[model samples]
Target: MFIEYLTNLLGTVYKVPGTIDPEKSFLELEVDSLSLAELGAQLADDLGIEVAEEDLSSTTTVAELAGLLESRGADIPA
Candidate 1:
């Protein structure tokens, strides 16, 4: 669920094209630090999950980010 949300957010909010592979690192996806920080802000606003930009940056892949959100109790829809 989080994967889907992250993918949609990346594509819609960040203007990322094509399918986002969960296993791929953000560096591989060409997502810059500024974009990751924006994405963290979006997650806080939209999902009520307070994620630090550094925490998001530390995550290596989309899947890891999803796991972090889940660990933080984000209500990701199935």
Candidate 2:
């Protein structure tokens, strides 16, 4: 669920390779710091919960991020 949402959030960017794989690292996916900040805001707005960028950086995959959201009790679409 989170992988799909995150994939849609990321949209598309040239020079980035691979699909939004659950196992792929965000850093390896070419997600920049600015994008991370934007993602933080988007998550807060959409989930009604805010998470620190530094906290997010510890995770390396879409699946991991989904787990983070789960751990925080954030909403995840079915």
Candidate 3:
């Protein structure tokens, strides 16, 4: 589920090639900031939650974003 979510979040740039481990950096996949914001908004809308723009500014990795989501009560699907 997380992988699917990530694939969609990543759009056409990066193909998430492995499990959605919360330790990897999205930057490593080449997902730029604009794409990241789009991904974040999509996540926020899909999950019916408010993902603050500040949160995106503060995060530099997929793990950190996942942690932020978790902190915001988003269920991290296995």
Leading candidate by lDDT: 1
Q: What is the TM-score (0 to 1) of candidate 2?
A: 0.77
Clashing pairs in 2: none
Give the local distance difference test score of model 2.
0.72
Query: Residue 8 of model 3: what lDDT?
Result: 52
Each candidate's TM vs. the true structure? 0.87, 0.77, 0.59
- The sequence of per-residue lDDT tens digits that candidate 3 reaches over residues 1-78 is 454455555554445555544455666665567766777777776775677766665235666666666677776443
* Residue 71 displacement in candidate 2 (angstroms): 1.8
**Distance from true location, Cα of 49 in model 1, Å:** 1.5
Which is the better candidate, 1 or 2, if ranked by lDDT?
1
Misplaced by over 4 Å in model 3 are 1-4, 7-21, 57-59, 75-78
Candidate 2 structure quality by residue, lDDT tens digits, 1-78:
677777766766323455677787778777877777777887898898887877667246778887788888887644
| Range of the 10 consecutive residues with the lowest summed lDDT in candidate 2 | 10-19
Which wins on TM-score, candidate 1 or candidate 2? 1
- Number of clashes in every candidate structure? 0, 0, 0
